[model samples]
Target chain A: MSYLTLSITLIFVIIPLILSKTFKLGLERDTIIAAVRSIIQLLAVGYVLQFVFNAENAVYIVLMLLLMIGAATQNARKKGASIKGITWKLIVTFLFIEILTQSILLGLDITPPTAQYVIPISGMVIGNSMVLGILFLNRFTAEMETRQNQTELILSLGGTPKQAVHTQLITSIKASTIPTIESQKTIGLVQLPGMMSGQIIAGADPVQAVLFQLLILFLLLTTAVTTSIMLGYLSYPTLFNQRMQFLRESLIRE
Target chain B: MTKAAIEFKDVDYTANGIHILKRITGFFPKGKITTLVGPSGAGKSSLFKLCNGLQTANSGQIYINNKLIEQYAPTVLRRTVGIALQEATMINGSVEKNLALPLTLKGEKLHKELAIELLKVVGLKESYMSRNTQELSGGQRQKLSIARTLVNKPQVLLLDEITSYLTVYPSRTSKN
Candidate 1:
């Protein structure tokens, strides 16, 4: 889109601002700030992508991917700040998802090892996996808190840490993945995903875009399950100590 | 007195920065009921947790059957020292499933007859086995919790306000 077209998108922002003012919702400031931040952030990423695409160095590609993973980890860690070392756990989860998804993509020759393909695809993979990680952590911690007594009872009844948390882990894993699973069940009928829409808008064949979107949906399903189980195993141990005692302090929300 | 089933050696427990049990040193004797009498918030529950390796002591050691509490695998230790909480939180299922949890964790078969016998021990009728736990009354739920704990055959059962839910003393109703 041209700068003129982008500038016209400001009118969309005005709708929220006008609504905030009309209803005295007091969200005008936040709306303005959010719009400005999105503009600056996207512009910054756009320039960086241009540079990376021009360079096409393997080192630069790896570095850019690391940067994305780091940012996503930091963002997702907020949801699980109650757990110690959660940021590192998220880093490992995102890194694993990125490596797994990209390796499969490049290994199978499904997508070319080009900056244009690799970077955007990695971004989507890392982004969705980060969200899945957050959902898993959130549900896991909440389950641990609400079911603290149950967990302890299990422990009291000769259960190992794995047994105590077995139910919660399964519940959280299912909870985190349900959204992705349900959304994919009605992907085309309910919403044409952004990737497909973007590809079609850029003049790609609709059928090809649909095929690519399907690939992404499958990758997302893998990510949703893998990230949840990995994060679940990694973080559950943190809820207890070496003595196999449930650390009640970890359940207290800060 | 017979050897203590569980011993607390200068145990100190803190929760939320408040000292709950300060330098507690005591023992609950084997094959005997040991009552820990205290007003509400008096660390009675905290003391029970320390015994079962559910909560680690802040600055002391606990022993179960003459072994350091930490030395035993928590899974093994918990099998010997069971605790039933005040709320008697039931799993989302029939009474049979809830009773089978401890055995399921141990990879043992769910003994239906044993569950019925334990139900009778906890003043619960055998018919309650197929009933959903959610449908039970508060007192019945507490009895179910006690029966579930007994399924594991814990050597030292820690009851936390368990009798508060029952109309009569649990001893009068319990056949065990």
Candidate 2:
């Protein structure tokens, strides 16, 4: 697309901005700022990706992967800041998802071992993991708050810390993954996925676009379930102390 | 003098800059019924929490069976001193499952007879065993919770407003 056509896309942003002003939604500043940020960030990433794709250096790939993990970790950490070492937990989860998905993709030759393939796929996997992390942490922490009495009752009945929060942890994990699972159920029928549509619009074969989207859908399913479970296991132990007492203060949201 | 099953020494608990409990010292003797009678926000519940290691005291010592509360593993201490609060929180399951919770935790078999007997002792019926905790009345749930605590057979029972919802107090608990 030419710069003029791309600038025309600003009409979409303008529509929202106009509607917000008309309704007095007070979202004008936020709407404008978000649009500006997305444009700048995406364009910068486009250039960076172009450079990395051209260089095709293994070090550049590693660096780009690190940058994605770092960004995802930074974004996802806010939801679980109360969790001890949440920053590292998020980084590890993102890195693990990237590595796991990439390993299978490259090892099986499912996708060529190229920056073009790895970078975008890593972005999707890590991005999905980050979102799952946020959803799980948000739900998990909320469960801890709502079910505090239930947890304590279990604790008071000779139950270990793991047993105390077992229900809450499991409930949170299940609750957070429901959206991903439910969305997957209606993937092609309910709505055409953006990636597949974009691929098809780029003149890729329809069947090939679908196959690639299916690959991402499977990757996301794995991402959704594994992210929550890993974070749940990693976060729960820290919510207690050595004596198996629930660390109430650590759960106190700042 | 009777042996103290649970004891507190100069226990202090403050929350949000308000001294909920300050330098509190007391004991509940073994094989004896102890009632903590206090108005709302009297920190009576807090005292029970400290006893079971649910809430750590800011500055004080708690003892379970004469050993420092810190010395006993929290699960061990709690199993030894089971507490049932006024608002009995029940797991989403059958009464039998709720009653068998402690056993489930310990990987111990929960005999059907044992669960039934505990339910009976708590003034609940055998039919209630299969009933969903959600369908139970406030009083029934309280009884189920008490039964759950009793399943593990704690040496000391901490009953917190345990009879508020009960139509008939399970007097047998005190008798035992």
Candidate 3:
């Protein structure tokens, strides 16, 4: 990337942080902490991945992916108040999407499924899907807790559990997918995404890079949509009862 | 009174091996406001959950309309027992979208007029019908929530500290 492009990307990132502080959404300390964390984590992962990709060891690649999944599972559980057995919900959703997509790619001979193919692709897939899953689960659970009455009213009024929580379920699902939809709409026109840029930097054909980027984006869209839907359905029942009321215990922190 | 909307008989509920509710028998009559009042940690909320079929009694039976609650379908029970809690959350969508949730899932029409009517009934103007729910104040959100529940005219409404967000007058109005 050119200095100009790098400068623009930094500006884009920093501008949001500055504006958020100025708007009083959070203190400057938060921005500082977030910035530091992002920087260090990315740098460390970059070096570690550099080694992994060159080594091309499948076992190492699988281990690194599990580490990511474990971290994400812990993060989700913490956010959702440490309800027993909830971590499995997140892990199942994350791993299902991750393994299913990677398997498809390997079966089709799309990528070699080696370290180079596995690490970056799995990282992007797991990382992005984890984020969407967290957002969906958090928002959906919170929504159920807050709107317990309305949801129950729906059930009492002859609506099914699916019918009652339908609004929140849909909102969570959409929240996970909207960014992907927006990026797809503006691909190439607004900006060339990181994957395509990386391929281009590595001396691949521009056309081929775009094609590959499109495939990755498609995979991301599918994974995100599927993960959010499954997670939403799975976690929502934990929030309500057979008789259609929100469980008070479920709503409260454990 | 008509047939009891819910009956708790010899209900015992324990969570993590801690008995929250112990052998409580009661009848919640149909169509009248009955508040479950008690001191903190007294299992008022636990009993409420039993009524709504959210929790099962470890050693007893809960019946809704003379049928075993455990035997009832969750979706069917939810449809029969409307419930709300203190935390009124707004989903990430327009007001119209949130209001249309029940109808939409049933594949019914949007009923824009009815949505606007409910918004007005809840003391909100038609303008809020298009606004994002996240932007509303706590009181307004609570009112919107009540309106959402009343949209389908539920048989029973389980309210858990729902009045916490409202002023004295609105709180009074909420019960009426």
Candidate 4:
């Protein structure tokens, strides 16, 4: 690796420690712990990828992706304790996003099933899916818990549940996409995103890197919006009953 | 004869197979404060929820404003039957934001003066309009909660142990 790459990695490793001390961010222990865990986890995955990459087995690749989807779904469940059956809902969304993106890349002959392409693309898709899952699940659970009455009250007042929660639904989608929006706005000017910078470091032309970055941004937007709206709508029926009353048991965390 | 503001007929509600409100039947008049007094777990809160359409009866019907409440939309019902529980929370925003939330939810424009006027009605100072609700005193927050309910000018307001959180004097002051 070039000295430049090494230097960038060093900065990523050091910045958190400096931030924790300078600002008394109060997250020093967790930051250190997470950094260590990430290093160990990434290294372990790297070793496993050596075998998977050589085999070039689509089944293995898909199995790995399924494992990731399962983990993401579990995290979502734990995060939103009252959200039952979200695992399958999330898996379906992940599968849809993944297959669609893979087809685009493969159809365009951009990158083959090699580890260099599939792994990174899958990583991006999985990472974004995880974030969207957390945001979508958190928004739904919190809104459902606190606003259940207002929701039912609106229904009683002659508004459908969809109409009653229209604002809330919009708010949830906005909350999920705001980070992506900010990143898109600040891309290039404020900070270098990983994919574009990685392409450049891999000796891709700057213009090519820019095009790839644009594609990634577009994909992220589509996935985030779709996953957020889907999760919100799917989770609604879980919170109410046939008579339209808020299900007390569904709202309670076991 | 005008229909009562609220009528619950033979309401039986069981959550998790445990009866919360059993065979409840009552009529609350409009333009008046009808207190539901009972010992703890006497289904007082459940009854309030049923009347507001927050909960449905297992085997009965509710009428609000002379119409079957179930026929009304959720948003409309909520707007008419304003509710404030003991754990009333002020959302993360200015006092004006919290007060104007109901109207805003109904797709109305912000009415800054309405928040201040309602705050004053609940014995809060006019200056509290700009303050963050988190910084308010307990009674101040309670008053603000009541003020929030009034944004829609709800025909019926549901209070669950609202005064229970206030200090000795403000409770008396607010009721009067």
Candidate 5:
């Protein structure tokens, strides 16, 4: 698309801003700022990705991947800041998902080992897993807070830390992954995911794009489950001390 | 005098910069019933938590059966000193499953007879075993909580205002 056509997309933002002002929603400023920020960010990323794709060097690709993981970790940690060492746990979980998914794709030759193919796929995987991590941590912490008495009762009855948080862990894992599962179930009926649409817009065969989208959807399911379960286990330990006592302060609202 | 079942020596516990219990020293003797009487917010529940491994004292030490509470592994310590909270949070299952939990954690066979007997001790009937705990009344749940704790046969039972939920206290409830 030409710059003029892209600028036309600003009409969408203008419509929202006007609607907000007319309705007295008080969201006009935020709406405008979000639109401007997205434009700048996406344009900047587009240029950087173009350079990295041109370089096609392993080091550049690795650096870009690391940058994505770092940003994703920082964003995801906001929901879980109550638990100690949450930042590192998020970093490890995101890194694990990125590496595991990319390695599987490259190792099995499911996708070619090229920046053009790897970068976008890695972005989707990392971004989705980050959201999944945030969902799991939020639900898990909420469960821990609400069920503090039950957890203490379990601990006081000779249960291990694993046993004490087992129910919450399972509940959080299921809760986080439900969106992914439900979205996948309704993929074709309700929405055409970005990857498939992007591929079709770029003149790829409809059948080929559908197959690739299927691959991504399945990989997302795996990443969602793996990230939630791993992060759940990792975060639960931080809620307690070495003395096996629940750190009540950790549950306090800051 | 018999050795104290549980002892707190200069125990201090603080939460959110507030001192809940400070410089507390006390003992509940073995083979004897000890009652802690105080107004609300007296930290009676906190003291029970310290007796087991649920909450550690901020300073000083707690002992169970004359051994430093911290010295025992949490699992062993908790098994020796079980606590029944006032709320009686029931597991999402039948009463039998809740009673069988302690045995399940210990990897022992669930004793059907003992479970029924414990229920009876806590003023519950044998028929309540298969009933879903969610369907139970508040008083029934409290009894089930006590019965569940007794299933582990903890030498030092910490009852944290558990009887407040019951309509009538059973004479056999404290025999252990």
Candidate 6:
């Protein structure tokens, strides 16, 4: 696509700006800022990706993946800052998801070992993990607060720390993963996914786009479940102390 | 005289810059009913919490069976001392499940006969075992809460405003 077509997309931005102003939804500023940020960020990433693709160096690919993981960890840590070592916990979860997905894609000869394939797929894996981490943390903390009495009752009954928080941990994990599972259930029917639609729009064959999308669908199912369960396990232990007392501090929202 | 199941010395507790418990020195003797009479905002619930090791005293030592409360393993201390708070909170399940939670935590299955027995002990009929806890009235829920605390046969029982709901707890005395 030419700069002309890219410029024409501003009309899409303009429509939201007009609608926001007319409805007095007070989202005009946010809409404009979002549009501006997307344009700048995507353009900058486009150039960076182009450079990395040409360099064809394994080091650059690793750096890009590290960069994505770092950003994801930083963003996800905010929601779980009260959790001990949450920064590393998020990094470990994201890294695990990235390595797990890439290894499968590579080991099976599913995708060529190229910067193009690795970087974009890593971005999706890390990005989804970050969102799942935030969802799990949010729900897990809320569950703890609402169920505080139940937890204490269990603890007062000789229940271990694990037993005290088991309900919250499992509830949060299932709650976070349900969205990903449900979304995939209606994928082709309710919506053409962004990656698949983008591939088709960029002139890839429909069949190839669908095949790639299916690969992503499966990878993300693994990503969603692992991210939630892994983070839940890592985080629950931190909510108790050596004496098996609930740390109450963990329930204090950041 | 009965032996004190729980004792507190110079216990001070503060929350949000407010001193709730200040230098409290007392003991709840075993094999006896100890009722702490106080109006709202008194430290009655906080005292119960401290006994169970659910919360520590800001500046005092607690003892259970003459051993420092902190020295005991948390699970062990909790198992020894069962407390039923005024605000009854039930797990999302049938009455039997809530009653058997202590046993479940111990990785032991609660027998159907015992579940019914405990239910009956708390003034609840055997039929109440299969009833959903969410369907219970406030009084029934409180009964279940107290019944659950008895599941482990905790040596020490601390009840907060229990009589406000029902005239039960004969078992705590009966067990002696």
Which one is best on DockQ? 5
lDDT of 1 by residue, A53-133 (tens): 999898889999999999998889876547888888889899988999989999999999999999999999899998888
Per-residue CA lDDT of model 1 for B19-49, tens digit only, reads 9989988788877777888999999988888
Name the weakest run of 10 consecutive residues (lDDT summed) in model 6 chain A. Answer: A77-86
Score every model by TM-score.
0.94, 0.92, 0.61, 0.64, 0.95, 0.93
Better of 1 and 4 by lDDT: 1
DockQ of 3: 0.28
Q: How well is candidate 2 docked (DockQ)?
A: 0.73
Q: Candidate 2: which pairs clash?
A: none
lDDT for each residue of candidate 6 in A1-254, tens digit (9 for 90 to 100): 88899999799989988998998999998998998899899999999999999999999999999999988888888755468888888888888888889888999999999999999988888888889999999999889888888887788788887888888989999999999999998999989999999999999999999999998888889999999999989888988878777878766875
| Residue B112 in model 5: lDDT | 87
TM-score of chain B of 1: 0.95
Candidate 4: DockQ? 0.22
Worst 10 residues of 3 chain A by lDDT: A239-248
Q: What is the lDDT of residue B44 in candidate 2?
A: 88
CA displacement after TM-score superposition, residue B165 of candidate 1 (Å): 0.7
lDDT (0-100) at residue A121 of candidate 6?
85
Q: List clash counts for every candidate, in order.
A: 1, 0, 14, 17, 0, 0
Compared with the true structure, what per-residue lDDT tens digits does model 3 show for residues A35-94? 779868987998888888888777878889999899988877776543346788889988
Estimate the overall C-alpha local distance difference test score of candidate 4. 0.75
Alpha carbon lDDT of each predicted model: 0.87, 0.87, 0.75, 0.75, 0.87, 0.86
Off by over 4 Å in 3: A1-43, A79-84, A242-244, B1-176
- What C-alpha lDDT does candidate 2 achieve relative to the native structure? 0.87
- CA RMSD for every model? 1.9, 2.2, 8.7, 7.5, 1.7, 2.3
DockQ of 1: 0.78
Q: Over 4 Å off in model 5, which ranges?
A: B172-176
- Candidate 1 clashing pairs, residues 3+ apart or interchain: A158-B79
List candidate 4 stretches off by more than 4 Å: A1-82, A106-109, A112-233, A241-245, A251-254, B1-3, B168-176
Q: Which pairs of residues clash in candidate 5, taking residues 3 or more apart in a chain or in different chains?
A: none
